[model samples]
Target: MFCPKCGATIPDSDNKEKSGSKVVKNILLVLLILVLMAVSGLGTAAYMMFHNKSSGATYEGKGYNTPEEAAKAYAEAFANKDINEMLSCCAIESYVDNLDYEAQIERYGAYMPTIFGGPIMTGDDEATRQINIEERKGQLTNFIIRAYLRVSQPIDSPIFSGLALQVGDGKEYDADEVVDMLKGASDIDSIKVGDVEDCYYFLQASSNDNSDKIHKTLKKVYGGKIEWLGVELEIDGEDYVMFVDAIQYDEKWYILAPHGTGASIAGLDVYSGGICELALLD
Candidate 1:
């Protein structure tokens, strides 16, 4: 047999001599101690490694070691409609503060469909709608239950989950309704959420398409070089472009938004057009 975690072979007890068995048992005990210690150390190391010093609970890891890797992971998470995983790929501090789990979930529920796809409309099927409602209820219930179980863990609480959930006239978003907006689109590139500098660089790099005009305009306000990308689509028979704002952190890429995230990052608004407006990708 092989050890599940490390894939190392484990000898059967029956094959060992009496003395060998004692040695093996001792070795196993030592290995177990080492494994426990490693696990304890790894948890801390992982937290420190992935955590953003300025923000709270933000983590970007698990093979998302490069800009391209993170971008792919982001796209995959979107494709999977995994909200937590998707948010992990991007810088979400602008909207999501620490221990603001409800807001995190709500924002995720709202923006995900818009950025990735649209709401799933159950077409006049009573049973389907009921099932969807039940599924959402189950998810929320599970979250509550898990949160309750981990009540002792201070970090687990999103600054008191029950209070957060109960506050305000919280609009209940049916979780099942969220769908991927980017399903039909091709894979995303390793673009980053750079500052005004990215805009400057984008304009500088391009010889045509109003480069000089755009460059001067950027310089007049905030100047920096960063990558800017546009995803094109047609909505309601009209051409619409989704501008992607990305940033590089620790050499990995993250999209600010599939569209501009309602605010600027690094003193640069990736897209100034209306949320539904069209911008030709020149």
Candidate 2:
């Protein structure tokens, strides 16, 4: 008999059992391939989803077309105590990209021998060293970001109220309370965007030598793709300005962290401080 699907002649009754087994094997093989393809598709989709989320491409507040818009959104998020929104407006991926473990090691390698009495060893081999560096970088980034978020809240909101942060003066205060005091005594009156050009110039002029080097490095790396904007928050009639470093990635703007105080906390060598005072208003 002829097989209808393949138009091939089927084995006769003499070989019927063998022919049946062959057909079953083929069917099983096709099913296995289908299953593998489905799994691969799902895996690819999942990876893409994760990448988009991490890169802020899928973030709701990531669609800001300009630096001013992003800064305004961040200020509004801060006022509303919206953590997710505030994070969305940040250029987290940019900060991550700028973290160069290899460069850091190279720059600090000379000092390591003096401190350790020998060459500081990261791992047994090159591959292992790379893996170890990446792991450390991830840990450092997480620590800095978490610390920043912990303090980046309204002082009166009760969020992170239990966490005590010591300011430049060596006085310990509740994270929330410190932020509230910095924001001012009353509710938010208005959020204003300062001139981008003027903000950039001010940042460059006011930055210390190390900070100036970082700014220049970032400018050299990003060229015309990055911007500096000042976000002025008028609370209780007092105008407090926060300078933000906005980076353009995939045609979207995101606020770069470790700009003011964040950078100081993370160490200026690890992350570059922007041209703003205290990195952020808070």
**Clash totals, every prediction:** 15, 6
**TM-scores for all candidates?**
0.28, 0.42
Winner by TM-score:
2
Supply the TM-score for candidate 2. Answer: 0.42
lDDT of 1 by residue, 163-246 (tens): 333233454433332222112222222222222222222222434566555434432322222234533333334443333445
Model number with the top lDDT? 2
> Model 2 misses residue 232 by how many Å?
1.2
The number of residue pairs in model 1 that clash at the backbone is: 15
Which parts of model 2 have CA positions greater than 4 angstroms off?
Answer: 1-63, 94-99, 104-197, 200-216, 219-224, 261-282
Listed per candidate, the RMSD to the true structure in angstroms reads 20.0, 12.4
